[model samples]
Target: MSEPVKVAGLTVRPGEKARSVLTIPNFWADGQSLEIPFMVLHGKKLGKTLYVQVAQHGSEIMGLDALRRLINELDPGKMSGTLIYCLPNPLAFREKSRATMFDPKPGGMNRIWPGDPEGSLTERMAHKIWTELVSHADEVVDLHTASRYCPVWVFYEADGVSEKAPSETARRSEEMARLFGAPVLYVETEAYGGRRTLRASCVDNGVPAIVPELGGHAHFDEEAVNIAYRGVKNIMKDLGIINGDAELPKRQVKLKWRADPKVYVSHCDKGGVFIPTVSLGDTVKEGDEVGFIYSPRSFETLEKVKSPQTGYVFTIRENPVVHPGERLVSVPEIIEWLEN
Candidate 1:
């Protein structure tokens, strides 16, 4: 066997057994450290390298739980290639915050991708992770969840492709999405010029990476966990990382856009207690009464919120309290396409 390669102060080896942890220094904090935890499971035989990561943003808890289960259940002895789990930004996790360090102007680590070695705390951490972990992997799965107020759903942002150029990237994305067994796949036609997003950086570097939305923020959902787990197992089987009979999903659903067609943000015209008359995933038509805004003191209905388009509801605000112009609903236009 060949000796492990060291890059950006991280030592990575190809072997039947592997374990390592990298402590990367944050740019903003001189004395503090950001622990990017990881575990490498190499099987007795050589195979492909796959990296799975969770909680790039602090608020997404489902991915973290899913990763925990995967680690506990996965046996390296029967496996093939290396499996690395990268968990960066451990501080936001402890504080139960979605993004950034605690107190005074919180920020998000997800937006700081392909990071600068001498930038802000989040930026520098991103740089170290990309240089040390992401660059070396053959396939990557960056897990995430919705915001604290939104419910669970599956969505991915991938670059568009043309017929002339080899669409290997787009094809890889679709294959991974199918392996994930999610109900939706969203492709971003335009690139968001941010240097810090993990998916964007990966695409720029010719890596086939994907961001999976397993569940909502903060709390753990069992259904979402099961789905994500199965998806991962299927991917491992497809990649030859593990040898076994993986159950492939019977059918696959593809969603072209991330934002739902019927999605309309019901902003509060006046600040008051928001009362939702409809639940998420409910079907409604244009002008249908979805909810009502009430005055906190008088208990009078101030405004009635109605659907703007005909579609299935996907997201509803969890917190009832609202400010002026707060979004209350997200409805996605359901499209059922027959396979050719």
Candidate 2:
């Protein structure tokens, strides 16, 4: 058996059943108290290490539910490998908010990649997580969902296109997504500017990682929960962590990629109440009216939202209220057969 890996000051021995919580000091309201909570599950058999983390952006709760169910169903005595469950920043989660204390003022934890141990609270937490949890794992799955006001479909972010070893990371992400059994996987090629982002950092260090969107935030949907739950189990099965057949749906959904940048941003022309006529997964063509914005009190149509390209809708705002320059929808310009 291979030797165990150490993360965040914790030593995880291979083929040993163990669970422990790693604390990050003063991550909450200033330097008042510690806030981050991580649960490490080391199975009794040696296998690949996988890090399953949730609530990095605060509002994504589907991952939490999935992780809860996973822990309940997983039996360490009948398993192999190590699974690390990390709550990188629990303050935002406790407050039921997206982004952390330093968000907007500085930025969200998800955007603060690699991190600085001597930086702000969020940065320190990020640095610890990277050194301890993320850097050690053979594969990483970061769970997320849309913000409180938006509902999005399941997708994966594999920003491996810009890298020199594109296919290497892309293939690993595709395999992980397939193991998770998600219906769709979206590849994001654009850079969002933070070097500390989990996905970016993983790729930078040659660790295959993908961030799966688990639907919406705050409230839980039974179907979405089931999808995420089974998906994690399937991933475990694929990793040889468990030795049993995973009951996956027969009609598995194939992955589709979005190739155009213009399809991802739809701005509100006039500030008012915005009503979406199309839902996530809907398809539209150029010049098609997607939605409209109007006065909430008067119900008068002030502006209309139209598709600028032929594509599939991936994300939409559920909240009717809108402001000028806000993103109302995100559609992906579909690319076929890239995976095959």
Candidate 3:
């Protein structure tokens, strides 16, 4: 039998299910408290513990629905390992804002990892989550959402300075991402800045992690929810936490990262109503006109937005109106195609 796991003042034994909330002290202006809710499922047999969290950014709520469905579907008594589903940032989630609105410097929750107990409000909450939950997990899945036009994909951390030789944790994270069954896999090869992110921090601590960016936000996207559900189940199966094989894509593309100036993202040169000529998942070569910015008043093309490199169009702005220097599209560099 699997041993008992304790977190957030709750102890879950083998073949059991439990839920609890971790209170964040000194969280509100009126001296009220905030709580981070989490669910635990401990299996009957011993296996790797997988920690999955959603809604780090409040508006990104699609993953939460997906997680709810997953929790309902999973049978803890028939499983071999444990699963932790957590909602980490209550302040942002409650306000439906990306950051804690009241904090003086509420950088998005994703930016800070292994946080400081005596730091800002957001940091204090993050610190509690890191120490009490994530630090105990063998693997992690950090769920996020992108624009409505963005396709579902997985991101694994890589060494930007030395892309060829990645750390063992990063390599394991890549394997998990592959089993996640996302159509696109993004390898974030950054040596710095990303270290503070949840997945990167897990990798730095020798715990494999992957961030699955689901499609759309703020609403119930059935397609995105299905994708998230399947991906999590696939990971569990691959990890021997559950029975069955992972249903993955026959072929998936891996994108190489560019940190210097964010070559993946193409910006608008002139402010206007931007219209995209290419849709998400479209392949385009460098210098190809992917979109055009037009002035509604003058009825003239202000500028033609082109692809920065030859790759897949992963993210396109859904909002037509845009200003100069705003991101119009993100086409990551396709490094290779993996056959599954």
Candidate 4:
């Protein structure tokens, strides 16, 4: 049997499940102290540890329901590894905002990893989580939600194919991302470019990590919730932490984009009411008309938004009203298509 696992002042023995909260000190005398609540499941047999976190941004709340379902279904007595689930930004989650007033900057939870104890409030919370929760992870998954019209996808950092041999960590991360079973997978080749994101920090520390971006921010996307729940189980199976085969889609789009993938976003050139003709997951070629901007006042077509590359549509604006420079649709540069 495996030994007991200790984290965040809670000790979870083999074949046991437990919950605890790590309290963060409020330096300001009148400020309320922050707390990060987490759950742990320590299995009977010795195996790897998987750490999953959600709601770094309060508005990105689709995964919470998914995680809730996952927790209810998991059984520590029948498993062979450890599972740690945590809410990284409780303050933001409480207010249903992207970032709280105590944070140093907007969306600071996702930006700061391996945080400093003596830093800002957000940084201090991150520090506690990293040292007390994430440091014990053998693999990591950070869940997030995007725009309402965005399609579900997985993102992991990888070096260019020609740059050098891929590290073991990168290879494992790629495998995990594939097993996640998302319809779209993004292999970012440029790395984080100085961003201290949780996923990047874990990868840098020699632990494999991936981020799954569920769709429909601030709302319950039923399909996304189901996908998130299934994806986590799929990864657990792939890691030999569970007993089952990963269920993947019939066809999946794998985009190995170099540098910044956002460069492929089709932005509205004229301020008007934008209408997107292409739906998410639609494949498109360069110069193909995907959307149009109609002047609401003049009742005339201001511009026809054409796709910038031959790829799949993963993000489309749901709001019809638009302004100059607002994104209409994003068709990232495609590298390969996988079929199972």
Candidate 5:
């Protein structure tokens, strides 16, 4: 028998659905308060509860589509555990960044997790959402996209977070990432624990979570959305929240991170007009040609940009213009994870 679930001031029994908007203690520039619109989906049988959220940052929007379509595909009448779906930080979505117009810091919401209840406006909002929503969940799935300048692949936390020893939890996290079916699965540990991202917060709190970084910046790509949609369904199936056989992508490659630079963020050496020759997901070798830099005035080629390592493009600035020492590309290599 499934137990009752409580969140956002609402209690949900098995085999039922409840929808509501959670009001947070924050406001927009116009003084309009912020809220997280959500739905509680309880399945007929007992199983794990998966908490899914999106749009913590303003620019990332595909999460909405994935959640909506996932809802359409998922029938609570036939589900097993419960699924909590919420859109956190509406102010960020309204302004298209993580921080609200009232936020003093321009940095987005991903860096802060389980935030301060009485702290900054954004942290206050984070505190309310975490306390009222994610705290009770058994698992978490956060959807996201790259900035307007580039595309990204799906990723999850790897072993050695906060420089601690690898645990079974990290392996469990990797298993969930594999079920996501994204061609590129980056196993990164650098952005864990202290970062305070929602996923990081959940991982630190004894919950296994994954962040699916779908491509398309500032807009929804039907192709990417479909891929994301399939990924979510696969996750739901894997968690036993919903009934279905999980679909797997062909040749899902794993990218392991060793350190900061090893993750492969390529920066511009000299300021100029940069043009990308490679698209997202294209393979590259160290010193492989990726793009070119040109003079802004006459648009004459000034430098030939090349790949810094042997990997695929995890992210690339779409804008042709570039500045010296600015991050122009990110090429993450495929690496094998060591057994525990």
Candidate 6:
């Protein structure tokens, strides 16, 4: 059953749609506080609660556009459950940086989840979100994009270590994944960057979640936005929150392994200007040449990079400037098409 939820000092009743700002006091230590913009669409009928988060990483701007379109597209009057969305970490978003402005580190605010109430800016922000919004979620969809390096794909956290089989979390996450309808789907077992992420936390908290990686990171791609909107809309339909059939694509590929393939990431051995012969969504043989590294001054070939595995070139390092040991490519062995 759906009940009224209190957020940002306002009680949002069922069958109501309200937009409120969750304010943080002394955000900048100059009597200036941060206000996170949020919207709640409480359906008249009872159903599952779906939490949609946008711009958590600041630089992932496609999610912001997707959410905006959702606000205009979905009709709460005919909906069954609640759709709560928020634009968190305004400081990082305003600066157009990946991480929080409080720190100059990588991974951004997403590194910290279920945040510390008495920690840094990101921590405090995360803490409030966890306590106020996230904990009450039944299902979640976090919008993010891969760095210029990783290509667009849908990712879900699954239990890699469980000896018995795929756990309930994995099943729910995978179900959500199939419903999302992306070109390529990556079932990120625990070994992949699943720790300390919001997705991991939600799963640990008994809330199944999925993160859809849009095309790029910096700017808003209308195409990417359209894809995201469809994903979110399909999830809503799947969860019975909205009354509609999920629109499915012609074909979808699942990045899989016969026995959970160990992903081999290729890093630059020598720092130089790198040129890639392959692009995203390309299939390659194990011994095929992928790209080359060149010296900036002479423009001479410094290194020739070849595929280590017969797989799909899912990720390609976009930036030419590379440092030794920096990741340049990620190739995952494509098992087969997900025949549903």
Best by TM-score: 4
- Candidates 2 and 4: which is better by lDDT? 4
Q: Please write out the lDDT profile of model 1 over residues 80-162, one tens digit for every residue.
A: 77677777767677666777553222437777777777776667667777888777687778888865544344444444533
Candidate 6, which segments miss by more than 4 Å at Cα? Answer: 1-4, 103-105, 148-150, 161-166, 192-194, 256-263, 268-272, 294-302, 321-326
- What is the lDDT of every predicted structure here? 0.66, 0.70, 0.84, 0.84, 0.75, 0.77
Candidates, ranked, TM-score: 4, 3, 6, 5, 2, 1
Model 5 stretches with alpha carbons more than 4 Å out: 24-34, 148-152, 163-166, 192-194, 257-263, 296-300, 336-340
Query: Which portions of model 1 show Cα errors greater than 4 Å?
Result: 1-15, 25-34, 101-107, 147-151, 161-166, 189-195, 216-218, 245-263, 335-340
Candidate 3 global Cα RMSD? 2.4
RMSD of each: 4.0, 3.7, 2.4, 2.3, 3.4, 3.3
Misplaced by over 4 Å in model 3 are 102-106, 160-166, 192-194, 260-262
10 residues in a row with least lDDT, candidate 1: 157-166
4 versus 5: better TM-score goes to: 4
Cα error, residue 284 of model 1, in Å, equals 3.2
Per-model TM values vs. the true structure: 0.81, 0.82, 0.92, 0.93, 0.87, 0.88
Q: Write the per-residue lDDT of candidate 5 for residues 126-177, one digit (tens) a residue.
A: 8887888887688788888866544445667777663432466677777778
- Backbone Cα, N, C clashes tallied per candidate: 3, 5, 0, 0, 3, 1
Return the clash pairs for model 6, or none. 99-108
Error of 6 at 30 (Å): 2.5
Q: Rank the candidates by lDDT, best first.
A: 4, 3, 6, 5, 2, 1
